[model samples]
Target: MGQEFQGGVGQVAEGDINNYGININLPDKPEFRGLVTAQRKELHELRAKCEELGDDPRDVWRRVHAQLGVCSISEITAEQFHEARTVISGRLEQLQEEADKRRLMGKILRSTAEKDARQEMLNFCDLSFGRTQLSHLKRNELQRVLEFVQQVEINPQPAAEIPQVQTAEPLQLREFLLMYKTNAAGLFLFGIFVGRFWS
Candidate 1:
């Protein structure tokens, strides 16, 4: 009869045989099975979250490993799991914020009248604020640009005035000629009527 080891698997007796003559070697720290399972599930969830946020899961894992001083997720202890979760969650939040800002910028640019309004805004930002991309601008700077664009839309610049042609002299001469012709015809008719009445 073989004695069962009360300690961890690390101190298990070598060459332990089962009833079917198969040697079984248990994993280290059998008591940590639950913790290990939970940690793996959390890691998978974190990776999915990274994908949803359009971030690289590998980079997230790198940050977690660096923060927790572990090469692999399996090596992370129960205490370190919380720290790793915090790091990953914070990164996801940051990514989400950046994505939202980008979406808002896109919406603002699309609301403009010009077909290439996005490029125009990019140029404006570069010239006025020294930022080539809207993404580079801070929240306040973006707000300023938004206000300026809205103001421009509200009060557009006036179009150039058309030059008037010099036709006043011609118009006056034409009117004078028309009046003279009318008066001459009226006098001729009056003279003819007077002669007929006398006859």
Candidate 2:
């Protein structure tokens, strides 16, 4: 029946482009063609966005690699590419949200501290994660950084002025030697002992 033909997925003309102007290799297979064409357009857009944001496309591939267990994006199938696009989009969204959170956290810090709060947050994040910038942090790491900033802002701790008390343990030979180099009393005692015994 014509209803049977109409009930299933439709077919496209051979050698035609999708709505996005991307060429489709399998026109008779509309579902596959549409999915692949859309994926291609998305990937193209993703690359452009990465260029605009000064992000490496390798980061996207890294996410894809983690999911597919493939080494590179080229090894991914069209369906896999579509899935990767979703994953990449989620990451991009998370990065934007993290930036906004950082901006808000900076504002809070600025209100409480007299110094450059934004710079302070940046420095803290850099030191905490061993990364150059907040943007380099992964999604979970970004959340952790946000929590850290909030905690610090909530209970802003001034620099500790009190020196830490040394543990109640006997200093070893290497420790004593280091102490002798730094402490004038230790150095003088060492000199006296050497003069009396070695000379």
**Model 2: per-residue lDDT, tens digit, 65-142?**
798777865566765766777777777775676666666555445543643356656676777788746556665666
How big is the positional error of residue 142 in model 2, measured in Å on the Cα after superposition?
A: 13
Q: Give the TM-score of candidate 2.
A: 0.35
What local distance difference test score does each model get?
Answer: 0.72, 0.64
What is candidate 1's TM-score against the reference? 0.49
Best by TM-score, which number? 1
Report residue 95 deviation for candidate 2 (angstroms): 1.0
- For each candidate in turn, give its C-alpha RMSD to the true structure in angstroms: 10.7, 20.3
What tens-digit string does per-residue lDDT give for candidate 1 at 66-161? 998889777777867778889888888888788777876766686555443555566668888997677788766777667656555334468898
